[model samples]
Target chain A: MDNIAGHKSSLTWAVHISVALLVLLWLLPTLGLLVSSFRTADQIAGSGWWAAPFPQEESLQLRTAGPDEMTQDGDLYVIEGNLLEQNGAGDLDISAWGTSARDVSAYAPGKTAEMRGGETMTLEEDGTYRLTSAEAFEGRGERVFVSATVPPEFTLDNYERILFSDDSREGMAKAFFNTLTVTIPATIIPILIAAFAAYALAWMDFPGRALLVAAVVALLVVPLQLALIPLLRLHLSIGIGKGYMGVWLAHTAFGMPLAVYLLRNYMVGLPKDIIENAKVDGATDFQIFTRIVLPLSFPALASFAIFQFLWTWNDLLVALVFLIDASGQTTVMTRQIVELLGTRGGNWEILATAAFVSISVPLVVFFAMQRYLVRGLLAGSVK
Target chain B: MNPALQGVIIVVLAVAVCVGYFWSSNQILDRVIFPAKGEKAGQNINRANMVRPWLFLFPALLVLGVYLAYPVVETLRLSLTQRVGSGYEFVGFDNYVQMWNEPKFREALLNNMLWLVVVPAASTAFGLLAAQLTDRIGWGAVAKSLIFMPMAISFVGAAVIWKLVYDARPLGQDQIGILNAIYLGLGGDAPQTWLTIPFWNNFFLMAVLVWIQTGFAMVILSAALRGIPEETVEAAIVDGAGPLRVFFQIKVPQIMGTILVVWTTITVIVLKIFDIVYAMTNGQFETQVLANYMYDKLFRANDWGVGSAGAMVIMLLVTPILVWNVYNARKEMR
Candidate 1:
């Protein structure tokens, strides 16, 4: 008994390790993209996102006032001012100043320079300096090095552009709405149709009942691409080609087989006693399906709805093949993101924000409806 | 009774009922479906009936028939005909013959074969592993949800995500793609097009499908794994089977049926896959599969005979699996 308990704990540990690794593997890229999306273009161009958040030293050129600003006061030509802004841009003290590029930042901002011919110069912290030279300011611009602390600044600009701007040919906002239009109906239609079909297949007794279910399963093998052109031809013939309606129909057609198969499996797994009781109460097939099966099959419907919605929402091929046009009215999130990659591929913020926008809906759907997915899948599998 | 008269009467009745139902339902559509003025019926009171089912089903079936079923038949017919624009002359099995002989079709067929074998197996294995691992952990639900999150992202979406991971840059630029960066970080030379590599590129492309589908397999397998009676495992413990042995010997056999179902389901999906290949690489770089091949032939090249022939080949290839699924489903029903 002790050995058995020991073995079980060891097994649990093993499971934990493996699960942790799998979750990490799944998360790494998405996290990377998310992080990269928030970074500025120059930062992204300069280093990997993994290198972000670390401090590094950088060189910059600074300038001080020339000898012209110098005044002959008392004995010394004193420069009185601050080298940095006190309130807004901040008090970054000047490290050094010099005349040549090589000797830039050689002297502190407040240091007075003693020239060979009794010439003098002084620089203060407020970027003002007095160069008390017997001669007027005749030299080139003064160069300086100031150690300025660059803070990590994040922007919502990428998101703003992806969501609001029309500059990107493949902006995610249009695609997002396009995906929504395609997915909402695609998700709802399949569930609606599949619910009825699932009911009829699960509970309704009719001639050729098994055959209809079999046909749907057969359809599970019919790859949409194989039907793409033919379907398009049929769509054009029927005048529903190349639009939201066409893509919706395409998704529904593609989505139906699984939806029916899944919902039917879930519906069939439902306790027979409830369905039997409904039938005995003189409820017709349709009534029992609506009143009894649908509500009880909420787990399955919701689960399937989530799956369909996500797929349709994330779909690009169906949209590309059927919905996309030059007018850009039918552009979807996936297509827009793809176009962004092609055009603004270097723009991490645009790409990541666009990606996030595209996935945001699915994320919500998954999180909110995830429990039903587990319940629905288990409901179909357990019994 | 007159048989012809009875047939006519039945047709007349079906048409009359349909017309009456439509005319009445137009008024009720806003009331029931759209629900104006907050008069919508609640769950208990709102009822669907025999007539309502047909009404709900009509538009769907019509759309399916026009867009789906009609094209399916038209594809089959188009396989036998040679098309010149909108018109076609029947050419019989010549298209089929030509497709069988075409080198590109053969290559696509082989790529699909690789996709079918590798993708489903790898996905199932990973999913099963993940499911097994998650089942023992305290945070199993969260872990499973995270892994399953990709399933919600569409094929094109996954491709988009992978594109960033596989984005290749020439030397001297910041590497955006992780894999290429790794190679370059290791002091490698130029970035290679991963999706464009021949034969093996198929497996690389298959990895995308595996990633997207692993969630599906994990979810289904996780459910199936949960359904494995705890009593059985406990009983196996009394027999002294180690954890690994117990998993293989007891748990695996118990859920074998579900595994086969999951594997086959993904197999069917893999067979129909055109989106990932189309979206990521457009079937270039020796990654072309049968479906995309069909699209190119039909849409790009305008070779109706070859396209139809390719479609037929896919249909034939997929039929056996479809039959197997149907058989299993029927058996499960029993």
Candidate 2:
């Protein structure tokens, strides 16, 4: 029995190790991207974002006041000042300091320097400096360089550039709104239609109901790509052409099968007793659906909404066929990110920040309503 | 009129009003849905039954029919027509013949075959493995959730994240892509385009979907694993079967139905796998599957006839799988 327990413990360890490794493997790249987003382009180009904090040392040229303020004592003229203010934007870990670009960081940050022919320089923590020279100070400049420890801090700079700056080739702000315009209506329209259909299919008891369900199930296997051209041509023929409205309609069309399937499944899982009771009370099918089914189906609706919203939000193919206008006005966030990757792919900061922006809403919604999703997926489990 | 007749008439009137409202709401919804639920209320018969289903089904069925069903039928009809420059001419199975001969179409078919065989198998295998392993440990739920987190990521978003990891620069350059970096770190020469390598690239791309789906597999398999009656396991133990033998001999057969269901569900998604391939490689370098191939010919190349043929072929390839799935689902129901 002791041996048996020991064997089980060993097996348990093996499982724990594998799970940990899997989680790390899955998370590392995303974590790398998140870290990379806060880094400068040069650092990103140089090393993995994981190494961002320690290896990231920067040097900037700074100037200090020269010998005019130096009081002549015997033959000594000295000049000293710290070039970096408390608010210096450059990031570096200070090991040394220097008075020349070639010899940058030659001295420590607090170290005083003695020059030849009666000159000395000193720098303080507050970035103040004192200089003394016996000889009159001439036109040559005083250079002060210091290095300091730079902690990793996230910045909104990438978001600023991607969202507002004209320099961005794929301006996310416009595309973001475009995606919302496409996604919201696309999600809403399908759910609205699917709910009514679901109510009819699940509770209303109609002929061909099984056929409709089977047809829907079959349609689920129909690749959207197969329908893109014909659908586009149909759109063009109908004068809706390629635009927001066209894309919205396309998404709604694509979204409907799953919407109806999911909603029907959820509605069917609903207690038949409640629906039947409503009917016996003469509440009417529509009233029963609206007042009882709709409210009870909230979790399912939210789950499907999350699903539809994410799909429509992330859709590029439908938009590519129907919304890919030369004008930048109709571009969605996914398309914008794709183009950005093509052009500014090297900029992890921009890529990560942009990705986070695109996914933030979905992430929030998922976390907030994850319980609904879990229950919805297993709606018929006990049955 | 009697009270029953009056009630029936009122219900019929209500259904008519709902159907009429659906018709006028949007043209897309009207054509798809009104036909499904719409029948004019009879003047003589009682209205309760006629109006009841129609009033309940009108809005939902209308939206589905217009957006989903109509497009499906229209796609089928359009598949038979040849588009020359700007106009379509009916061309029957010529498109089908063309699709059969198209090299890209063949590659797409092969790639899809690879996807169907690989993704579900790998996902189920790993998920089952993880589930079994985690069940031994206590932290299985958290581990499963962590793995499943990727499923929450949108396809395009996942593509974006992976693109950063697979980033390639010139030879002797610092590798930004994780795989390339590891390769370089092992004293190897510069970057390789992971997404652009044919044949193997399918596996690489399949890995993404697998990553996203394994969590789903783990969840279902975990439940199924838990569902094995402890009494059965105890009986197996009493028969002197080791844990491994008991798991294989006792637990597996009991949960075989769930395994197939999960496999089939994922198989359906894999059959329509255009997004991952499109987002990652745009189906370049032998990475093109049927869905992407269909999209290219249909939307990019504007070869409506061939594209439709491809679509039909996809439907054909998937039908057997669907039939098997329905059969399994029915068995499970029983």
Off by over 4 Å in 2: A1-6, A57-153, A166-168, A379-383, B1-47, B136-138, B169-174, B187-191, B326-334
Task: Give the Cα lDDT of each candidate.
Answer: 0.71, 0.71
Candidate 1 structure quality by residue, lDDT tens digits, A1-383: 22565756665666677778889888776776777778776555555666668632223455555555555567655333444441243544445556546665667766876655576657665556555545445564344455443445467777877788876474666566556656665666566666666766677555566766767667766666567777777678788768866776788778877777788887877999987887788765556766788898887788777667767777666787788876887688877766766777667667777888877778888888888766655554333
Q: lDDT tens digits, residues B40-122, model 1?
A: 44431233332344554464456556555676787888889886666888888988888878787888898899898899999
lDDT of 2 at B148: 66
Superposed model 1: Cα runs more than 4 Å off: A1-14, A56-151, A168-170, A269-289, A378-383, B1-64, B96-103, B168-175, B181-201
Residue pairs with clashing backbones, model 1:
A82-A125, A82-A126, A82-A127, A83-A125, A83-A126, A83-A127, A84-A125, A175-A332, A175-A333
Best prediction by lDDT: 2
Chain B alone, TM-score, model 2: 0.81
Instruction: Give the proportion of true interface contacts each model preserves, from 0 to 1.
Output: 0.41, 0.46
Model 2 chain A worst lDDT window (10 residues): A374-383
Cα deviation in Å at residue A272, candidate 1? 5.1
